[model samples]
Target: MTAKPPTPVRRFGSIVGTVLTYVAIWLGLVLLIAGVGIRWFWGRITVRDMMISLQNVDLPAGYTREWQGFYGIVVAPLVIVLILAACHAGHALRVRTRRLGAWDQRPRRQRRRTRALSLGLALILVVTGASVFSSSVGLADFVRASRSTMDIGDYYAAPEVTGSENQRNIVNIYLESGEQTLSDTNLFEKDPYAPLEEQTSDWQSIEDYQQYQGGGWTMAGLVSSQCGIPLKGTIAPWYGGGNTAPPDSIRTYLQGTTCLGDVFKQQGYKNVFMGGARAEFASKDTFLQDHGYDEVKDLDLWKNSGESEKDFRPDWGLSDQRLLDHAKDEIDRLHAESEKTGQPFNLSMLTLDTHEPATAYDYCPVDTESRLISVYQCSMEQVAGYVDYMKDKGYLDDTAVVIQGDHLKHMTSSDSFHEQLDRNDHRSIVNRVWVPGQENKRRLRPGIDQLSMYPTLLEAAGLDIRDHSAGLGVSAFTDAIPGGSAQALGPRGYRELVATDSKDFYTRAWDGEEVHG
Candidate 1:
């Protein structure tokens, strides 16, 4: 009798099995690649950052490009090969099994080979799944541990206007990757921020006090500086969403929260945030606009506002020089508008030239082993020049200029000259407050963090901050309350202050929980 052809049902089942096997293999590979990539790129994966990505928040253009580049270079081709190999193997196994007819009829060697192949693939998938699951559980445990512990207590001063309407024009500049390490003589042959040091030395420096807070990057640093709280993300969906909801919608993230911009808005100040980099990254646009910024102009905004085509967009955004130039012009316009409205203005500027990973724009005189040093030096000159311009324009006379590094340089000890230095000893941001035309005053503040700047911002603008504590941070310029200062917390306490998600008093502020003194 002739061998009967396989039924359509059998054929379909075989095909389905093959497809399922291929899909399983592909998924395993993809998961492995993703975990490895995140680990490599981010150094450490935080729930907050993961949530931001899951929420589909638009990352900066440069970052997006880099991510795509990484995928193209690493994942895409590997996935295709894996899928094809898995499919081929499944098809061959299926054909072999079919030819064998019954499992008992098949040769022992053939049966064992088939069983081994099936078991091997299953084992790989099982292992991969277990790994992913364990990692997720680890993150959850970390969050739980953080939330259970506490450091920052009920440290908030309700920010009442003490004396006069201390509404000085505010020029706040955030230098990217600018750190105290740049000035550490042991780290470099020559100080990279020498120019910045000279300019800001007369201004108030918070070098004596340094502590880790909620700032390790640009966006977090900005939030920490403005809110007197670290930008810690909640595991539960923020802004009234369920736990599994995405964090994409940042517009209402701070609905109940108050920031420096909000305070300025309440005080009748025109708040403007100008940064050369894309403001869309890290929900900066949403955060700033929603907080109280009247105008949030970024590189895209500048381009749309009729900038010359001759200006080539670099990998990041506009160069520091160009950004400062544009900032000067924007300040002039805001000053003019403020004059007409008789309202004080807050000009928030973020520089992009000194950003990390690589230096795309270098215009520094310093000769250094690391390119980052050169970048910082270049930034220093531009910052000093801008300050000088403000002085020449007589803008400084009425402006409270607060120049600070958004965060410590995002380089490993091996990545720079700080390889030999203790991590804690070398990690600090550049903090300087200059009340244009006032005799430069040096305050002996020690062990401060990013949160200190929030109250200090108002203080520099001439407001006498009652009790000096605003939100979770205290002002570096004022006398510290007993439990308020980082010195009181100590280094370990300071780290714990921002590390745990449980500091409801501090984290709740992000969700607009009313902070009481």
Candidate 2:
């Protein structure tokens, strides 16, 4: 007896089920690949950091490899789905052509077992994908940390600027991925910071300069050192709401908080910022403009300059060599104006050659076996040369220079120094300070982090801050810290405070409210 064909409704339901199954398979594969890829690229980044990076998605040209890898991962799932569809199509065609006799007439028990196994495989994929994805994005960690109710506002201290007797010109340089760990000859083959250290041998150095939580990136580092607070994003994952999304919607950056630039502006200093990367890359320009920078020069300015296109790096903008050369000219012009007008100026700049996926410039010789190390050496050499130029021009007599790392090197899988850095437990941010007419050098107070740099920088520039405190930090220039300040809380306690969720406190900060105890 011949069996009758299925009803139209039954055929339609069958088609829908097949389509849903393929969708599920593709989604599962995509989730798994993306989760694994994120881990491979950025190694267990915090959810706050991830959110900030996502909201400000202006990536530099140097991240070509990362972009290409992401595209491949996304397409992999589609390729897999297509192959599965082709296999199903071939099986259906064989059945329709009647090429196999008992293919569709297999035992009911065998068919049921096959269906059960396939369902089991699908379940495994979905579960594994969800697990990996959640872990990679720090979802579990965020949830755990949300339970704590530590408020930064409790320890916050508003900067009390009592005015300086003699305002000195300030030159602050933020080194990309600068860490003293790179100078540990015990870990690596040689010290990449040797040139920089030799140049600033007479400058005061800060020891045990810990990198606090939330200050592990460039923007975060900038905020922490200048504003004396961790850079928190608007997302309140604990509440499952975006109540404080000002960073995305508003042009003002931390309008409620007082930063180095703001203080310098009040002091009648002409604040200027220059960098090799685009100022708009991470809304850096917005932050500087809002905070009180008079002039901001970046990749756009360099592109418009009459320099050869070959002078620029394809990934980031200009090479450190070119950036420092331009910086010399800027300082000369600024200094001349300051001398004539008797007005002190602030010049801040960030270097780019030491950024990840670093490349060697033609002007710099390859002294080390690793290209990354050579790049580091070359970049440091250029910065050191710039310092020498400042010294030659007699700017050091009336200037305060602060040279520090923006943050520790990100130990992603693509980074070259992870093998050495991962093993060392005593890693710290590299920093050097130069104050005008200082006869003796004093060690910075122990157990202080980037927060202390806020007051420290102000003091270096001849400003007198009350209690040597600003925001949550106490100036490293003094041994005494206020009783309730964040520095007095110690590094361990400070980390715990910053790790927890402080939505209300941060909301006030973003809203430009004066938050203080």
| Strongest candidate by TM-score | 2
- Model 2 residue runs over 4 Å out of place are 1-144, 235-250, 490-492
What does candidate 1's lDDT look like per residue over 1-517, in tens digits? 3334457885676566556656566566555655655544444444544554556434355545346635643577467757687776787788769877432344545645875686479559746854663363246544554565564444445556565465688889988877776676765767877787776666777764343433466767777788776665554335411112214446555445578888889888899988887877767888888789989888897778776644434566777787888888888998888778888989998988776654545354546667767777887899988988887888877888888888776533124543433234446677777875443464636657777778888878776666766766777775555565544666655555555654455355555666664
Report model 1's TM-score to 2 decimal places. Answer: 0.67
Work out how many backbone clashes candidate 2 has. 1
Positional deviation of 157 in candidate 2, in angstroms? 1.5
Task: Give me the runs in candidate 1 sitting further than 4 Å from their true place.
Answer: 1-153, 209-211, 236-249, 306-313, 339-341, 360-367, 412-424, 436-439, 442-444, 482-494, 503-517
Q: What is the lDDT of residue 126 in candidate 2?
A: 74
TM-score of each: 0.67, 0.74
RMSD values, in order shown: 8.5, 6.4
